[model samples]
Target: MTAIITTTSSATDTATLEPGAEAPANAGEAAAAASEAGAGAPALTGEHTDLLETLARHRFFLRFTTKDLTDEQAAARTTVSELTLGGLVKHVALTERRWMDFVVRGGEAFANGFSEREAEFRLVEGETLAGVLARYEEVARRTEEIVAGIPDLGAGHPLPEAPWFEPGASWSARRVLLHLIAETSQHAGHADIIRESLDGARTMG
Candidate 1:
């Protein structure tokens, strides 16, 4: 189930990033800028003008938080729980793979060890923080490739077998992408709070 996030800010024009900074020239720059901005800044690029701006924004958030941390730091718990910045990265990667493979491709089976759909938020023992981040990066790259290869965002794909998903129902590629963006963005918020609570690191620009 999707969690409801209530904000006083306007949803249509909410600032996901700081003003005065130039839009990133590439994914690396975008990812770095997102880390500096923390969760307070816009997740999307101000100069972004694409059919997949929403998807890009969501990707920005995921990459930003997962960028530039030492394996130990990424895995370190700021609180009493098992959630870590790295763990969140893994979770997003797992979700991306599942959505793309199951919902988008209508695949009945998935590759082993990439993720466990039933255990969202639960980090398994012996899963190194670095390993999780690396896997997340790989999965994200694959997802990007898949999205780019699609000729039409309006093209339909089968739905997963869930109560929320209708049997034999299909979704436009656009909807699937948007759902990913929204899902990642929300989790990024959770990561932001967890990071801050751990070390008092404020959100970046």
Candidate 2:
């Protein structure tokens, strides 16, 4: 097993961990710490700003895709194994593609092209971590470009397959961007915990 050291520093105290470290087991304690740290933060600008800020904060976890680690190391799991930083990047890329392609672009259903959307959770053989990360960046950039091109939030787009999205259902492009940001931010939290367990490398700082 490989190891990495992490240091937690405060005004007057410092603590160190060995390569294989167990995070504080108390969930409440962890939540409390995070809440205390965020207490004085100013109000967020808007829905888009709030969501984008959340996603940017977790970009550190994406760095693991380029780090020297195997699929197992990225996942930090031994049993019922299925999760990795690379896999998460792939998943996010596919997710962004699906939302933009299907929901926004109103194209052919991805389900026909990729039978299992959740396959992103499994790392396929021959797929390098670097390649996955690169693809993720590409998709993210494209999504941003598409979002920038949209000028109206009330524009109606056809959703041929979405039951809830009726043919005339309209949504602002801003709403879609915010939704994607929220989704990515949620997954980034998952990546943070998985990465920390993998090598004791803290994702937050």
Candidate 3:
């Protein structure tokens, strides 16, 4: 994003940079300003608290997408894609459980491939929306507990041989939390769209 050049450059709104400092002109400067501002925010007690906070933020959006929807509505294919609100809920929960396995265990966790992974993105029979939601809640609570007990956020394991993940990369526990954020956020958007199509409902105003 383009930042304000100078305090005198604009009168509509003053961009908050350092005191008497000119606004950033580049991404690096913008990041620096943001870091400075964030530094002034209250310090988090630990990485677990920080990670859980982020996880909870994205989780809210995802869960909102499923709110007030009937089991049939959640399973309905409101969009051309196979995604449904219930399916997305199930998918994200399984994702968290799998990633948690990666965090606790390593490459040996679930040695499977794409050929066996497509089922995850579907709300199969017997998996009600409420049931899936409860499962996700359990996973969320368990994840917070796991994160709270970690020594540090630096723990990690090499990624498995999967076609989807980046090749030859190891993810730190911190990165795992970031991945969780991405997982929930991307699906949250999809879920929101599906939810709106299913009815006139929206996850956000």
Worst 10 residues of 2 by lDDT: 1-10
lDDT of 1 by residue, 1-205 (tens): 0001111112311233222232234343443343343355333222222434445455555445544466666777787777778778778877877767754546453335334655556456677666775676566655655665666667765655556667887777677667787888788777766666655553332
- The alpha-carbon deviation from the true structure for residue 5 of candidate 3, after best TM-score superposition, in angstroms, is 40
Model 2, 91-198: lDDT tens digits are 877877777775465546344755656667756767776677667656655554454344454453554555655666554555555666677767766676666666
Error of 2 at 175 (Å): 2.6
lDDT tens per residue, model 3, 1-205: 1111111112312333222232224223333343344455433355566566666656666766665567888889988899888888888888898888888988766665335358677777887888988888678767766776677799788999777778998988899899898888799889877877776665543
> Which model scores highest in TM-score?
3
- TM-scores, all candidates, are 0.63, 0.61, 0.74
Please give the ranking of all candidate structures by lDDT, highest first, separated by commas: 3, 1, 2
In angstroms, the error of model 3 at 27 is: 28
> Residue 39: error of model 3 in Å?
26
Candidate 1 least-lDDT 10 residues = 1-10
Per-candidate local distance difference test: 0.55, 0.51, 0.67
Which residue pairs in model 3 clash with each other? none
Where in model 3 is the C-alpha error above 4 Å?
Answer: 1-44, 113-116
